[model samples]
Target: MCLNSLLFFRCLDALVHFKHLTSLIADHNPITENCFLPPLPKLDLLWLNHCKISSLFPWVSKLKESCPNLQHLCLMGNPAAPSYFNGGTFYEYLQYRLFVISQFPSLNHLDDRKVTEDQRAEAQRLYKRPFFERIIKPGSGSFSQLVHSSVTWSGFQNKLTTLLGKDKPNDRNLMI
Candidate 1:
Protein backbone atom coordinates (compact mmCIF):
# COMPACT_ATOMS: atom_id res chain seq x y z
CA MET A 1 0.00 0.00 0.00
CA CYS A 2 1.09 3.57 -0.70
CA LEU A 3 1.34 5.33 2.67
CA ASN A 4 3.34 8.30 1.40
CA SER A 5 3.02 11.78 2.86
CA LEU A 6 1.24 10.46 5.94
CA LEU A 7 3.59 12.10 8.43
CA PHE A 8 4.10 8.81 10.24
CA PHE A 9 6.46 9.60 13.10
CA ARG A 10 6.87 6.27 14.88
CA CYS A 11 7.04 2.55 14.43
CA LEU A 12 4.52 1.09 11.97
CA ASP A 13 3.63 -1.92 14.02
CA ALA A 14 0.21 -2.15 12.35
CA LEU A 15 1.70 -3.30 9.07
CA VAL A 16 2.37 -6.78 10.40
CA HIS A 17 -1.14 -7.69 9.35
CA PHE A 18 -0.17 -7.67 5.70
CA LYS A 19 1.68 -10.92 5.62
CA HIS A 20 1.59 -11.22 1.85
CA LEU A 21 2.34 -7.63 0.97
CA THR A 22 4.64 -7.58 -2.03
CA SER A 23 5.23 -3.85 -2.09
CA LEU A 24 5.03 -0.94 0.33
CA ILE A 25 5.72 2.67 -0.61
CA ALA A 26 5.97 4.87 2.44
CA ASP A 27 8.12 7.70 1.17
CA HIS A 28 7.99 11.31 2.29
CA ASN A 29 7.16 10.29 5.83
CA PRO A 30 9.22 11.07 8.93
CA ILE A 31 9.64 7.40 9.80
CA THR A 32 12.55 6.78 12.12
CA GLU A 33 14.54 3.79 13.28
CA ASN A 34 11.80 2.76 15.68
CA CYS A 35 9.82 1.30 12.80
CA PHE A 36 9.23 -2.31 13.81
CA LEU A 37 7.77 -3.91 10.74
CA PRO A 38 7.31 -7.66 11.08
CA PRO A 39 8.21 -10.37 8.65
CA LEU A 40 6.78 -10.01 5.16
CA PRO A 41 7.99 -12.97 3.22
CA LYS A 42 6.60 -11.78 -0.12
CA LEU A 43 7.77 -8.20 0.08
CA ASP A 44 9.96 -7.37 -2.91
CA LEU A 45 9.79 -3.61 -3.35
CA LEU A 46 10.00 -1.28 -0.39
CA TRP A 47 10.37 2.44 -0.97
CA LEU A 48 11.20 4.42 2.12
CA ASN A 49 12.82 7.26 0.24
CA HIS A 50 12.89 10.74 1.77
CA CYS A 51 12.36 9.31 5.24
CA LYS A 52 14.55 9.73 8.31
CA ILE A 53 16.40 6.46 8.63
CA SER A 54 19.67 7.60 10.20
CA SER A 55 21.75 4.47 10.74
CA LEU A 56 22.37 1.32 8.74
CA PHE A 57 23.55 -1.20 11.35
CA PRO A 58 20.49 -2.56 13.16
CA TRP A 59 18.08 -1.39 10.51
CA VAL A 60 19.85 -3.27 7.71
CA SER A 61 20.04 -6.43 9.75
CA LYS A 62 16.41 -6.17 10.79
CA LEU A 63 15.20 -5.64 7.25
CA LYS A 64 17.39 -8.46 5.97
CA GLU A 65 15.66 -10.83 8.36
CA SER A 66 12.12 -9.46 7.96
CA CYS A 67 12.04 -9.00 4.23
CA PRO A 68 14.19 -11.77 2.93
CA ASN A 69 12.64 -11.56 -0.54
CA LEU A 70 13.08 -7.83 -0.86
CA GLN A 71 14.94 -6.98 -4.05
CA HIS A 72 14.25 -3.29 -4.61
CA LEU A 73 14.77 -0.81 -1.80
CA CYS A 74 14.86 2.95 -2.35
CA LEU A 75 16.21 4.94 0.57
CA MET A 76 17.63 7.86 -1.38
CA GLY A 77 16.85 10.79 0.86
CA ASN A 78 17.51 9.02 4.14
CA PRO A 79 20.69 9.73 6.07
CA ALA A 80 21.37 6.04 6.33
CA ALA A 81 21.55 5.70 2.56
CA PRO A 82 24.12 8.55 2.23
CA SER A 83 24.16 10.60 -0.95
CA TYR A 84 25.51 13.96 -2.14
CA PHE A 85 22.18 15.64 -1.44
CA ASN A 86 22.51 14.66 2.21
CA GLY A 87 26.01 16.22 2.54
CA GLY A 88 27.70 12.84 2.07
CA THR A 89 30.69 12.49 -0.20
CA PHE A 90 30.74 10.19 -3.21
CA TYR A 91 33.01 7.86 -1.26
CA GLU A 92 30.43 7.67 1.51
CA TYR A 93 27.70 6.94 -0.98
CA LEU A 94 29.77 4.17 -2.53
CA GLN A 95 30.53 2.76 0.90
CA TYR A 96 26.85 2.81 1.79
CA ARG A 97 26.03 0.92 -1.38
CA LEU A 98 28.76 -1.59 -0.72
CA PHE A 99 27.57 -2.15 2.82
CA VAL A 100 23.94 -2.61 1.80
CA ILE A 101 24.79 -4.80 -1.16
CA SER A 102 27.01 -6.91 0.97
CA GLN A 103 24.31 -7.38 3.55
CA PHE A 104 21.58 -8.07 1.01
CA PRO A 105 23.25 -10.20 -1.57
CA SER A 106 19.83 -11.11 -3.01
CA LEU A 107 18.99 -7.46 -3.59
CA ASN A 108 18.97 -6.52 -7.25
CA HIS A 109 18.33 -2.78 -6.99
CA LEU A 110 19.09 -0.09 -4.44
CA ASP A 111 18.14 3.59 -4.32
CA ASP A 112 17.99 4.58 -8.01
CA ARG A 113 20.45 2.14 -9.53
CA LYS A 114 20.86 -1.51 -10.37
CA VAL A 115 23.53 -3.57 -8.60
CA THR A 116 26.43 -4.03 -11.00
CA GLU A 117 28.81 -6.95 -11.17
CA ASP A 118 31.85 -4.93 -10.16
CA GLN A 119 30.04 -3.45 -7.22
CA ARG A 120 28.93 -6.89 -6.09
CA ALA A 121 32.50 -8.20 -6.37
CA GLU A 122 33.83 -5.28 -4.40
CA ALA A 123 31.18 -5.82 -1.76
CA GLN A 124 32.16 -9.44 -1.42
CA ARG A 125 35.82 -8.48 -1.09
CA LEU A 126 35.06 -5.79 1.48
CA TYR A 127 32.65 -7.88 3.49
CA LYS A 128 33.79 -11.48 3.45
CA ARG A 129 31.86 -11.84 6.72
CA PRO A 130 28.93 -9.85 8.04
CA PHE A 131 29.91 -6.52 9.57
CA PHE A 132 28.23 -7.10 12.92
CA GLU A 133 29.66 -10.60 13.23
CA ARG A 134 33.15 -9.11 13.18
CA ILE A 135 32.43 -7.01 16.24
CA ILE A 136 33.20 -9.97 18.51
CA LYS A 137 36.21 -12.24 18.05
CA PRO A 138 38.27 -13.66 20.92
CA GLY A 139 38.23 -11.23 23.83
CA SER A 140 36.42 -8.33 22.17
CA GLY A 141 33.47 -6.54 23.73
CA SER A 142 29.86 -7.39 22.97
CA PHE A 143 28.03 -5.79 20.05
CA SER A 144 25.80 -3.76 22.35
CA GLN A 145 28.82 -2.26 24.08
CA LEU A 146 30.32 -1.35 20.74
CA VAL A 147 26.99 0.17 19.71
CA HIS A 148 26.80 2.36 22.82
CA SER A 149 30.42 3.44 22.47
CA SER A 150 31.52 6.77 21.07
CA VAL A 151 32.06 5.85 17.45
CA THR A 152 33.73 8.65 15.52
CA TRP A 153 33.89 8.90 11.77
CA SER A 154 37.66 9.30 11.76
CA GLY A 155 38.12 6.12 13.77
CA PHE A 156 35.80 4.22 11.47
CA GLN A 157 37.61 5.59 8.43
CA ASN A 158 40.97 4.62 9.85
CA LYS A 159 39.79 1.04 10.36
CA LEU A 160 38.23 0.90 6.88
CA THR A 161 41.38 2.31 5.28
CA THR A 162 43.46 -0.26 7.10
CA LEU A 163 41.13 -3.04 5.98
CA LEU A 164 41.28 -1.85 2.37
CA GLY A 165 45.05 -1.40 2.59
CA LYS A 166 44.69 2.12 1.20
CA ASP A 167 46.74 3.73 3.95
CA LYS A 168 48.36 7.02 3.01
CA PRO A 169 50.61 9.36 4.96
CA ASN A 170 48.48 11.02 7.66
CA ASP A 171 45.37 9.39 6.25
CA ARG A 172 44.25 8.49 9.73
CA ASN A 173 44.01 12.21 10.57
CA LEU A 174 41.53 12.95 7.78
CA MET A 175 37.82 12.87 8.74
CA ILE A 176 34.97 12.52 6.34
Candidate 2:
Protein backbone atom coordinates (compact mmCIF):
# COMPACT_ATOMS: atom_id res chain seq x y z
CA MET A 1 0.00 0.00 0.00
CA CYS A 2 1.20 3.49 -0.88
CA LEU A 3 0.44 6.54 1.29
CA ASN A 4 3.04 9.02 0.15
CA SER A 5 2.64 12.79 0.21
CA LEU A 6 -0.57 12.69 2.23
CA LEU A 7 0.62 15.08 4.93
CA PHE A 8 -0.07 12.42 7.52
CA PHE A 9 1.16 13.72 10.84
CA ARG A 10 0.84 10.36 12.57
CA CYS A 11 0.93 6.70 11.70
CA LEU A 12 -2.47 5.73 10.45
CA ASP A 13 -4.36 3.55 12.91
CA ALA A 14 -6.40 2.40 9.92
CA LEU A 15 -3.45 0.38 8.55
CA VAL A 16 -4.10 -2.44 10.98
CA HIS A 17 -6.77 -3.73 8.62
CA PHE A 18 -4.26 -4.73 5.93
CA LYS A 19 -3.20 -8.12 7.25
CA HIS A 20 -1.62 -9.30 4.02
CA LEU A 21 0.32 -6.14 3.32
CA THR A 22 3.90 -6.70 2.16
CA SER A 23 5.10 -3.30 1.07
CA LEU A 24 4.33 0.25 2.21
CA ILE A 25 5.49 3.56 0.80
CA ALA A 26 4.88 6.42 3.22
CA ASP A 27 7.26 9.09 2.01
CA HIS A 28 6.78 12.86 2.29
CA ASN A 29 4.47 12.59 5.29
CA PRO A 30 5.12 14.45 8.50
CA ILE A 31 5.13 11.32 10.63
CA THR A 32 6.84 11.93 13.93
CA GLU A 33 9.49 9.79 15.60
CA ASN A 34 7.25 8.56 18.41
CA CYS A 35 4.32 7.52 16.26
CA PHE A 36 3.07 4.03 17.18
CA LEU A 37 2.69 1.74 14.18
CA PRO A 38 0.60 -1.39 13.97
CA PRO A 39 2.40 -4.67 13.42
CA LEU A 40 2.73 -5.91 9.85
CA PRO A 41 4.29 -9.36 9.98
CA LYS A 42 4.28 -9.97 6.27
CA LEU A 43 5.79 -6.60 5.53
CA ASP A 44 9.16 -6.86 3.76
CA LEU A 45 9.73 -3.34 2.47
CA LEU A 46 9.03 0.13 3.87
CA TRP A 47 9.84 3.64 2.69
CA LEU A 48 9.68 6.54 5.13
CA ASN A 49 11.59 9.27 3.38
CA HIS A 50 11.29 12.99 4.10
CA CYS A 51 9.55 12.59 7.44
CA LYS A 52 10.08 14.35 10.75
CA ILE A 53 11.85 11.38 12.30
CA SER A 54 14.82 12.55 14.30
CA SER A 55 17.05 10.61 16.65
CA LEU A 56 16.74 7.00 15.62
CA PHE A 57 17.78 5.90 19.14
CA PRO A 58 14.67 4.05 20.30
CA TRP A 59 12.71 4.42 17.09
CA VAL A 60 14.76 1.74 15.31
CA SER A 61 14.02 -0.73 18.05
CA LYS A 62 10.33 -0.04 17.76
CA LEU A 63 10.50 -0.60 14.01
CA LYS A 64 12.37 -3.86 14.55
CA GLU A 65 9.70 -5.03 16.95
CA SER A 66 6.82 -3.97 14.75
CA CYS A 67 8.24 -5.26 11.50
CA PRO A 68 10.37 -8.26 12.31
CA ASN A 69 10.51 -9.44 8.72
CA LEU A 70 11.26 -6.07 7.18
CA GLN A 71 14.13 -6.50 4.71
CA HIS A 72 14.13 -3.29 2.68
CA LEU A 73 13.91 0.04 4.53
CA CYS A 74 14.45 3.59 3.40
CA LEU A 75 14.89 6.47 5.81
CA MET A 76 16.54 9.03 3.54
CA GLY A 77 15.49 12.70 3.85
CA ASN A 78 14.61 12.21 7.53
CA PRO A 79 16.57 13.80 10.32
CA ALA A 80 17.53 10.34 11.43
CA ALA A 81 19.35 9.65 8.16
CA PRO A 82 21.19 12.97 8.24
CA SER A 83 20.99 13.88 4.58
CA TYR A 84 22.25 17.10 2.96
CA PHE A 85 18.70 18.50 2.87
CA ASN A 86 18.87 18.94 6.67
CA GLY A 87 22.53 20.07 6.66
CA GLY A 88 23.64 16.71 7.99
CA THR A 89 27.31 15.97 7.55
CA PHE A 90 28.77 12.97 5.73
CA TYR A 91 30.17 11.53 8.95
CA GLU A 92 26.76 11.76 10.59
CA TYR A 93 25.11 10.02 7.64
CA LEU A 94 27.69 7.22 7.72
CA GLN A 95 27.13 6.75 11.41
CA TYR A 96 23.38 6.68 10.86
CA ARG A 97 23.68 3.93 8.25
CA LEU A 98 25.98 1.86 10.45
CA PHE A 99 23.67 2.21 13.42
CA VAL A 100 20.60 1.31 11.35
CA ILE A 101 22.30 -1.71 9.80
CA SER A 102 23.36 -2.85 13.23
CA GLN A 103 19.79 -2.72 14.51
CA PHE A 104 18.23 -4.54 11.55
CA PRO A 105 20.42 -7.53 10.85
CA SER A 106 17.86 -9.02 8.50
CA LEU A 107 17.58 -5.88 6.43
CA ASN A 108 18.80 -6.33 2.84
CA HIS A 109 18.53 -2.73 1.69
CA LEU A 110 18.60 0.74 3.21
CA ASP A 111 17.65 3.93 1.45
CA ASP A 112 19.08 3.79 -2.10
CA ARG A 113 21.81 1.26 -1.46
CA LYS A 114 21.80 -2.46 -1.01
CA VAL A 115 23.25 -3.49 2.33
CA THR A 116 26.69 -4.85 1.54
CA GLU A 117 28.34 -7.46 3.72
CA ASP A 118 31.27 -5.13 4.34
CA GLN A 119 28.92 -2.48 5.61
CA ARG A 120 27.14 -4.98 7.80
CA ALA A 121 30.43 -6.17 9.24
CA GLU A 122 31.49 -2.61 9.90
CA ALA A 123 28.19 -1.86 11.56
CA GLN A 124 28.60 -4.86 13.83
CA ARG A 125 32.13 -3.84 14.69
CA LEU A 126 31.12 -0.28 15.45
CA TYR A 127 27.98 -1.10 17.41
CA LYS A 128 29.18 -4.27 19.16
CA ARG A 129 28.85 -2.29 22.36
CA PRO A 130 25.67 -0.25 22.70
CA PHE A 131 26.74 3.25 21.62
CA PHE A 132 24.35 5.09 23.96
CA GLU A 133 25.80 3.27 26.98
CA ARG A 134 29.13 5.01 26.44
CA ILE A 135 27.53 8.46 26.40
CA ILE A 136 24.78 8.21 29.03
CA LYS A 137 24.68 5.74 31.86
CA PRO A 138 21.65 3.94 33.18
CA GLY A 139 18.75 6.01 34.58
CA SER A 140 19.52 8.99 32.39
CA GLY A 141 15.97 10.39 32.64
CA SER A 142 14.67 8.47 29.61
CA PHE A 143 15.99 8.02 26.06
CA SER A 144 13.99 10.99 24.79
CA GLN A 145 15.86 13.17 27.24
CA LEU A 146 19.15 12.00 25.82
CA VAL A 147 17.96 12.73 22.27
CA HIS A 148 16.57 16.15 23.20
CA SER A 149 19.84 17.12 24.84
CA SER A 150 21.69 17.01 21.52
CA VAL A 151 19.08 18.80 19.42
CA THR A 152 19.86 22.40 18.48
CA TRP A 153 17.44 25.14 19.54
CA SER A 154 16.10 25.38 16.02
CA GLY A 155 15.47 21.66 15.87
CA PHE A 156 13.55 21.83 19.13
CA GLN A 157 11.44 24.68 17.80
CA ASN A 158 10.77 22.69 14.64
CA LYS A 159 9.59 19.74 16.70
CA LEU A 160 7.28 22.01 18.66
CA THR A 161 5.89 23.40 15.42
CA THR A 162 5.13 19.90 14.19
CA LEU A 163 3.46 18.88 17.45
CA LEU A 164 1.28 21.99 17.87
CA GLY A 165 0.46 22.29 14.18
CA LYS A 166 1.49 25.15 11.88
CA ASP A 167 -2.00 26.69 12.29
CA LYS A 168 -1.06 27.76 15.82
CA PRO A 169 0.68 30.91 14.56
CA ASN A 170 -2.42 31.94 12.62
CA ASP A 171 -4.59 31.30 15.69
CA ARG A 172 -2.39 33.56 17.82
CA ASN A 173 -2.74 36.40 15.27
CA LEU A 174 -6.56 36.24 15.54
CA MET A 175 -6.54 36.93 19.29
CA ILE A 176 -5.36 40.50 18.84
Candidate 3:
Protein backbone atom coordinates (compact mmCIF):
# COMPACT_ATOMS: atom_id res chain seq x y z
CA MET A 1 0.00 0.00 0.00
CA CYS A 2 1.22 3.46 -0.88
CA LEU A 3 0.32 6.75 0.76
CA ASN A 4 2.93 8.88 -0.82
CA SER A 5 2.90 12.64 -1.25
CA LEU A 6 0.44 13.31 1.51
CA LEU A 7 2.25 16.47 2.55
CA PHE A 8 0.36 17.05 5.80
CA PHE A 9 0.33 13.44 6.89
CA ARG A 10 1.13 13.23 10.59
CA CYS A 11 0.21 9.84 11.99
CA LEU A 12 -0.17 6.19 10.85
CA ASP A 13 -3.21 5.34 12.93
CA ALA A 14 -5.11 4.56 9.74
CA LEU A 15 -2.90 1.54 9.19
CA VAL A 16 -3.51 -0.23 12.46
CA HIS A 17 -6.05 -2.62 10.96
CA PHE A 18 -3.80 -3.58 8.10
CA LYS A 19 -2.00 -6.17 10.19
CA HIS A 20 -1.28 -8.37 7.19
CA LEU A 21 0.35 -5.56 5.25
CA THR A 22 3.80 -6.63 4.14
CA SER A 23 4.87 -3.58 2.15
CA LEU A 24 4.22 0.13 2.55
CA ILE A 25 5.35 3.15 0.53
CA ALA A 26 4.64 6.27 2.54
CA ASP A 27 7.38 8.49 1.22
CA HIS A 28 7.11 12.27 0.97
CA ASN A 29 4.96 12.45 4.06
CA PRO A 30 5.55 14.02 7.44
CA ILE A 31 5.84 10.76 9.32
CA THR A 32 7.65 11.08 12.63
CA GLU A 33 9.08 8.72 15.22
CA ASN A 34 5.93 8.86 17.33
CA CYS A 35 3.80 7.65 14.44
CA PHE A 36 4.87 4.09 15.10
CA LEU A 37 3.39 3.65 18.56
CA PRO A 38 1.53 0.52 17.41
CA PRO A 39 3.68 -2.05 15.70
CA LEU A 40 3.37 -3.44 12.22
CA PRO A 41 4.64 -6.92 12.97
CA LYS A 42 4.43 -8.35 9.42
CA LEU A 43 5.71 -5.37 7.48
CA ASP A 44 8.76 -6.49 5.48
CA LEU A 45 9.33 -3.60 3.04
CA LEU A 46 9.07 0.12 3.88
CA TRP A 47 9.84 3.04 1.59
CA LEU A 48 10.30 6.47 3.12
CA ASN A 49 12.87 7.79 0.69
CA HIS A 50 12.12 11.50 0.67
CA CYS A 51 10.24 13.30 3.40
CA LYS A 52 10.69 15.72 6.24
CA ILE A 53 12.73 13.34 8.35
CA SER A 54 15.45 15.22 10.23
CA SER A 55 17.20 12.29 11.92
CA LEU A 56 17.34 8.57 11.15
CA PHE A 57 18.71 7.28 14.43
CA PRO A 58 15.66 7.98 16.59
CA TRP A 59 13.18 6.81 13.98
CA VAL A 60 15.04 3.56 13.23
CA SER A 61 15.61 2.94 16.92
CA LYS A 62 11.86 3.05 17.50
CA LEU A 63 11.28 1.06 14.33
CA LYS A 64 13.30 -1.87 15.66
CA GLU A 65 10.53 -2.61 18.15
CA SER A 66 7.67 -1.56 15.87
CA CYS A 67 8.59 -3.36 12.67
CA PRO A 68 10.76 -6.24 13.78
CA ASN A 69 10.41 -8.11 10.45
CA LEU A 70 11.34 -5.18 8.23
CA GLN A 71 14.05 -6.34 5.82
CA HIS A 72 14.05 -3.65 3.12
CA LEU A 73 14.11 0.07 4.00
CA CYS A 74 14.65 3.19 1.91
CA LEU A 75 15.56 6.53 3.44
CA MET A 76 17.93 7.67 0.73
CA GLY A 77 16.65 11.10 -0.24
CA ASN A 78 15.45 12.32 3.13
CA PRO A 79 17.06 15.03 5.23
CA ALA A 80 18.05 12.43 7.79
CA ALA A 81 20.25 10.69 5.22
CA PRO A 82 22.82 13.47 5.26
CA SER A 83 22.96 13.54 9.05
CA TYR A 84 23.48 9.79 9.09
CA PHE A 85 25.97 9.66 6.20
CA ASN A 86 27.65 13.02 6.74
CA GLY A 87 26.67 14.74 3.47
CA GLY A 88 26.11 11.46 1.60
CA THR A 89 29.76 10.44 1.79
CA PHE A 90 28.88 7.04 3.23
CA TYR A 91 30.40 5.17 0.31
CA GLU A 92 33.57 7.24 0.45
CA TYR A 93 33.92 6.70 4.19
CA LEU A 94 32.72 3.10 4.11
CA GLN A 95 36.16 1.80 5.09
CA TYR A 96 36.63 3.98 8.14
CA ARG A 97 33.14 5.01 9.28
CA LEU A 98 29.92 3.25 10.15
CA PHE A 99 26.47 3.95 8.69
CA VAL A 100 22.82 3.18 9.45
CA ILE A 101 23.20 -0.61 9.62
CA SER A 102 23.99 -0.50 13.32
CA GLN A 103 20.66 1.10 14.26
CA PHE A 104 18.61 -1.85 13.07
CA PRO A 105 20.35 -5.15 13.65
CA SER A 106 17.75 -7.10 11.63
CA LEU A 107 17.83 -4.91 8.53
CA ASN A 108 19.12 -6.84 5.51
CA HIS A 109 18.84 -4.27 2.70
CA LEU A 110 19.13 -0.50 3.07
CA ASP A 111 18.59 1.94 0.23
CA ASP A 112 18.10 -1.08 -2.07
CA ARG A 113 21.53 -2.57 -1.32
CA LYS A 114 22.33 -5.53 0.87
CA VAL A 115 24.17 -4.58 4.10
CA THR A 116 27.45 -6.43 4.41
CA GLU A 117 28.40 -8.25 7.60
CA ASP A 118 31.54 -6.14 7.99
CA GLN A 119 29.53 -2.96 7.67
CA ARG A 120 27.09 -4.16 10.31
CA ALA A 121 29.87 -4.98 12.75
CA GLU A 122 31.61 -1.64 12.22
CA ALA A 123 28.35 0.25 12.61
CA GLN A 124 27.63 -1.49 15.89
CA ARG A 125 31.03 -0.55 17.23
CA LEU A 126 30.82 3.05 16.06
CA TYR A 127 27.26 3.68 17.16
CA LYS A 128 27.57 2.18 20.62
CA ARG A 129 27.32 5.62 22.24
CA PRO A 130 23.88 6.32 20.79
CA PHE A 131 22.68 2.84 21.71
CA PHE A 132 23.85 3.21 25.29
CA GLU A 133 22.39 6.69 25.56
CA ARG A 134 19.00 5.44 24.47
CA ILE A 135 19.07 2.75 27.16
CA ILE A 136 20.84 4.57 29.97
CA LYS A 137 19.47 8.07 29.52
CA PRO A 138 16.21 7.26 27.75
CA GLY A 139 15.13 10.89 27.33
CA SER A 140 14.89 12.01 30.97
CA GLY A 141 16.06 11.57 34.59
CA SER A 142 19.52 10.61 35.84
CA PHE A 143 21.29 7.35 34.87
CA SER A 144 22.20 6.63 38.49
CA GLN A 145 18.57 6.87 39.57
CA LEU A 146 17.34 4.71 36.73
CA VAL A 147 19.90 2.01 37.53
CA HIS A 148 19.44 2.14 41.28
CA SER A 149 15.66 1.95 41.30
CA SER A 150 14.75 -1.63 42.22
CA VAL A 151 11.19 -1.29 40.92
CA THR A 152 12.50 -0.13 37.55
CA TRP A 153 15.09 -2.90 37.45
CA SER A 154 12.62 -5.58 38.38
CA GLY A 155 10.11 -4.41 35.80
CA PHE A 156 12.78 -4.25 33.14
CA GLN A 157 14.08 -7.70 34.02
CA ASN A 158 10.59 -9.15 34.01
CA LYS A 159 9.88 -7.70 30.61
CA LEU A 160 13.17 -9.04 29.27
CA THR A 161 12.55 -12.49 30.68
CA THR A 162 9.04 -12.54 29.26
CA LEU A 163 10.26 -11.56 25.81
CA LEU A 164 12.94 -14.26 25.96
CA GLY A 165 10.41 -16.82 27.22
CA LYS A 166 12.42 -17.53 30.36
CA ASP A 167 11.05 -18.08 33.82
CA LYS A 168 11.48 -15.39 36.48
CA PRO A 169 13.54 -15.91 39.64
CA ASN A 170 10.75 -17.69 41.51
CA ASP A 171 10.02 -19.97 38.55
CA ARG A 172 13.59 -21.11 37.99
CA ASN A 173 14.10 -24.89 37.74
CA LEU A 174 16.93 -25.44 40.20
CA MET A 175 18.45 -28.91 40.40
CA ILE A 176 20.14 -28.37 43.75
Give the top-scoring candidate (lDDT): 1
**Model 2: how large is the Cα RMSD against the reference?**
13.0
Judge candidate 1 against the unseen true structure and give its global Cα lDDT, from 0 to 1: 0.79
TM-score of each: 0.73, 0.68, 0.59
Better of 1 and 3 by TM-score: 1
Per-residue lDDT of candidate 2, residues 14-68 (tens digit): 7789867999988888787788878888899999998888878788888888888
lDDT of each: 0.79, 0.77, 0.65
Report the alpha-carbon TM-score of model 2 versus the true structure.
0.68
RMSD, every candidate, angstroms: 7.2, 13.0, 13.6
Best by TM-score: 1
Poorly placed runs, candidate 1 (over 4 Å): 1-9, 130-176
TM-score, model 3 to reference: 0.59
What is the number of residue pairs that collide in model 3? 0
- TM-score ranking, best first: 1, 2, 3
- Candidate 2 segments exceeding 4 Å error: 1-9, 130-176
Model 1 pairs in collision: none
Give the alpha carbon lDDT tens digit for every residue of 53-163 in model 1.
Answer: 998877888888899888998999998877888899887888889888877877899999999989999887776554554434536677778789898888777766664
